[model samples]
Target: MFPLVMIASLVALGLLVVYYVGGYLFQNRSLSDIPAASPWAALTRFWLVREARFGRRYLTVDDAHKTHGDFVRIQPNHVSIANVNAINAIYGHGNGFLKSDFYDAFVAVSRGLFSTRSRADHTRKRKIVAHTFSAKSVMQFEQYMHQNLNELLRQWDLICQKAPANSKFARFDCLPWFAYLTFDTIGDLAFGSPFGMLKNGQDTIEYMDYPGGPSKYMHAVDALSRRGEAFAVLGCLPFLKKIGHLLPDSFLRNGVRSGSQVAGIAIARVGERLASTATKGTERVDILTRLMEGKDVKGQPLGREELTAEALTQLIAGSDTTSNTLTGIFYWLLKSPGVLAKLQAEVDTVILSPTDEVAFQTVKNLPYLKACMNEGMRIHSTSALGLPRVVPIDGPAIEICGRTFEPGTVLSVPNYTIHRLESIWGADSDQYRPERWESLTDDQKKAFVPFGHGPRSCVGRNVAEMEVTLAMATLVRRYDFELYQERFETWEGFLRKGFCCEVGIRRRMT
Candidate 1:
């Protein structure tokens, strides 16, 4: 009996090995033309998964693109393309390509605007809130931005004044501070009330205990950060999400908890806003009110669930992306003294007071300031990883990077790699030089997609730009930053998330 059991176990092990090897050989044969990032990458999705787990997926893919020509197989079926032309072909309107299943991992409540895969669904969702995100609409919300900006300045001023006994400069981490400002600003804009993150100088926020029950406080920013990292890893091969519970990885388990917390927060905010409107009958027009008034695909007001999803999307999209950009702007500014001086001079011309809330119109017109913003965005893109898209399984083969790829092939144009392409941005593409944006050719312009391109581009682009510019101008005009760390460290997630950026701030004498 023991001999017979051993023989069966040996047979099962041999069969599994044969299956894996056979499948690997078949995949290699099919994608024979494209170069693989590694031998294991051509065999399994686990290679990319491991890289993502370690927060080096973007960097690893970027290196592979540099080694291989235009395209590199980061996974068996997924190709990471460095060509700018592929952006339009893959993400442009009427381009047959659709968002891959990778996005489904990010669906916390429901498929929000950013996570939705269906073209029709995305179009419907876009129409519902398009006006709310327009430039004119964003302009209406400038007061909220200014309000938070003033609060941020007040806090910073106190810190600077209380600088260590004899030290002229005060030390603080800009990343969390920026996060607090953006979080409070977006919460006010979206939910009709600020989260008070800025005033408290913490990432904690209140959410519903139950319907009309009570409110609970949680570390909202930490959850969002962990969610980004977990989602980035799981999204690569969404199947992992199913068996994720069985896995012993603490990050994945913590991610699930974090996702639930974010979802609860969104639900509570939406519910509270709705309850306030119904009972108080206040006449205020904010993003939430507009969304409440907007019609859904069925020509009816959006349901609570749908509203929660969209509201949650706005909070996530508006906060980290803008904060990361602002952090990058300051990081690069402090790193390049010449650039910082030129930008400070430009900002000084427009900004009249240290405590004044810098207007968008004034800051928007500053050429050198705009250059630094563009350069910072280009060099330290928040969404550094490739936005993944898929060829239709039933449609004809599509062309990218002068190569024909069949349907069902995953194509990702990593912005990190594209922004640094030597052919388009010249040899100094890797350098953090604001002067590069002074004269951009048509080709270079096409490649500069910090917020992405096409119909699916960020609807909140106008708002994000306004917030980042306003905050950057205000801060740069008031204070001079000295870097505490020699190098800026970044972690990979859905967006290229930032770690702490510690710096010494002193009130500018001039």
Candidate 2:
């Protein structure tokens, strides 16, 4: 009698496992019309996770869009929509869409603007920090940009002189140079001082308080990025996440360790700023100071933790975005000689001295220069994957791609796929053509989402655009460059993904 009872219990357990394992299908039956990336995608997040693990998830989204039309099921509940029509519905302020919990993986402790899921919280934080990133406020950082770009040019000048006279070009990887320059710029803009990356030609984050000898802020961010890539893919699986936490002394922990190090740097910078200002009673002008001084809608200033998180957010987002966009712009320009020549002509016509810093105001309104920038940004989606946002649990059902999606459904639009779509862009969308911007109709222009669309769009975009435009025009005005390798390629990391190749550079001989 006891044995029979035990056998019956085992059978019931097996049945329950099967039902719940396949429950994703039954729950999402309303999404039957939507095409899945694969048969497995409907059952598990592992399929998408596999693409992410290989660092080709962007390709997966792009391939799915090509095969499945507009709406593709990336997971059982998650769908990727490429049409511009969904922009206002998903990301619009009044649309009631909230950022998905997927961003929770990025936050170290206290959630900042990038990862916070609470609408009220984000609204308050955005209100507090929004002024610091405004056009007028961002221009205050222009001097920092000029100083760093000049230092970068000085480094490249040294490399140019070091080149053998017989050689037509000097080989220098703009990848790290861009990184160094951007970090230094952000450092000076964030704290009262730069990281000295440009002066040193290396990523050096000095912490007088740190016990260990060397500190590279960019390296910490890189380590965090690698681990973020891993977590982003694998963390989708609940069992895998559980297993990850169980592993002792694993590489996964490095992400948090690196993030804490970055946090330490921000905290240290804040402390220094606070300390100097308090004792000396001197005013220090930087992003951190603004963050500390700014008040939320509640009229509450940021606490120490909140202040650190905001500072770290600005540094990471600003440096990576500017550096990567500049990298993409140069890569495209070098790959297309006619485009390069045209851009150079445009810049040369405007600038009296190639050696002087490219002033932001001078290049800000240049048509071809702006066109080149827009093209580069479109070709290389800064975010890579779709910026995922969820349908609010309490909001009304919405229609997308001729189907109704109830609350609790997930939606996103991958910038990479949308930017390269043949319908949105012409058949030559894959090609680098700055001139395409000139003929863009109202509909075509609406699809352009380099800085994203709506209120939730990147706050640091103004600063990023100004600095990139200035830096790119400056480089083109001063140097002639060619790709060192026969072909240019890059791996899509979590951030700063573009042009992982050496460029042969030389002073343009007039």
Candidate 3:
């Protein structure tokens, strides 16, 4: 029995050695064959560790491109390419590259628009809700947005009026305000019910007595989604997946539960909208309404489950992204008095007056104001990190800055890094200079991509721009703002979400 056990152990040891040797050989061949850029050192084994530890892991991959040229190998299997031409080849229409499993962290129920891996699945899902955000649908919902903005302006005016005679005015956190506005706006559009955020001046949505408000729960979910990426890297080792769950029950489970609760709210809201369609008068025609009532290319109405998932995805994407952008822009405006004055001047000249109400279309046309907004977004990009995409099976070898990446490799181009590229935007790229935008030729403007570029760019771009334009125009018109606190530090976690800004606003006595 002892002899037999020894022989079995020897065989297992031999198998382990063969596996390690084969892995090393494969990695060596892959790294050696690639025509990588001069800067990329050929060290395959510790690439992931170096990227996670030494490198600016939190800075968007765009920084990597600026430092390492257009294509930089991040890990053995991962490369980040920031070339404009590659955007078309990779994410353009009919591009066969699938979203990498890195996005699996973003998925909730193994199905949903953002979570689904297949192109066909995405097409079908996108089709069902396409009309909801259509030009007409957005126009129809203008009243809802206008009402919310009006309320927000009213609150600001009251805050301005109530400022102490001697003491500085109440410093406001734009993050929460934008969060309130965005959640209320999306809530009204998606569920036909505003969370009354503007009414309450906060996110007061109730679900299981979760602390830190609904937005906090949302933030938790956003943070938890990145855990799967960590798991994937660690799980490459034996028994890691099984052991990972045993490490500790952190915010992940709470986040998943919160996400599920949010999804449940979306599902319930859809049902309520459908039930009240008869009496609701014209159905409001929000994205949720169109999604529930619209048909696919096959002329088939979306299934009930599909409708719920799509609606939930729209609410999350639409609300969170716009909120983050607004918060970032507002923080920047508060930080720079010069930029704020310029933006205020532009607003006053174009859209702001004692009797004139700021309209989205009019505000959007103000070039300086637009430049300020664009520059703010460029510097403090919400979607700082690049969306990961896997190379297609039979696609051409991706060549960037003289280096060719192999097919089936994962690549990303973080907007955070791209926006800061000195070569593209010149030396003031790191500085918040709206004038730089004014001086740029049309060709230069093409590189400013806060909403991303190409066919798969943000579907809600128009709505987001309009919302932000109106909000900023309104705030600038009524109040002269200053940063109450000097330095604002960012908490870098899952997304490049902004915080730590406390601004004091006073009513313009003109």
The candidate scoring highest on TM-score is: 1
lDDT of 2 by residue, 1-510 (tens): 569989998998687556645667577888877899888777766677677766788888889889988899888888999888777678877888888767766675368888788989989999999988877788788887888888888899999987777897888788878878888888888887887877876665644233233544445436535555655654454345434555453554554455566666766777677777788865656688788889987799998778877887887788877778888778887887698889888888878777766788888999999999999888877667887888889978888657789889889988888888888798998998999988887667877887778877888888888888888898889998888765556666565375476889888755
lDDT of 2 at 469: 87
lDDT agreement with native, every candidate: 0.85, 0.77, 0.64
Model 3 pairs in collision: 62-417, 63-417
Per-residue lDDT of candidate 1, residues 1-510 (tens digit): 569889998998687656655656764465767899998888777788899999998898889988887889888788888988888888888887889989988886678888999988888888898878766778889998888999998899888987898888899898999999999999989988788988998999876644465777789889888888888999987877776666689998788667767877888988888888789975666788878888867887777878888998899988978888898778888888687778888888878776666889888878888888999999998899998898988899887777888888888899998888999999988889988878999988989999898887998899898898888898888998788887789998877877889999988766
Clashing pairs in 1: none
82-170: candidate 3 lDDT, tens digit per residue: 66555556666776778776555445333677767788888887776666778877778777787788777778777777777785576
In candidate 2, stretches whose alpha carbon ends up further than 4 angstroms from where it belongs are: 1-23, 206-218, 234-253
Q: For each predicted model, how many residue pairs clash, with residues at least 3 apart or on different chains? A: 0, 0, 2
Give TM per candidate: 0.94, 0.91, 0.82
Deviation in angstroms for 258 in model 3? Answer: 3.7
Alpha carbon lDDT at 82, candidate 1: 90
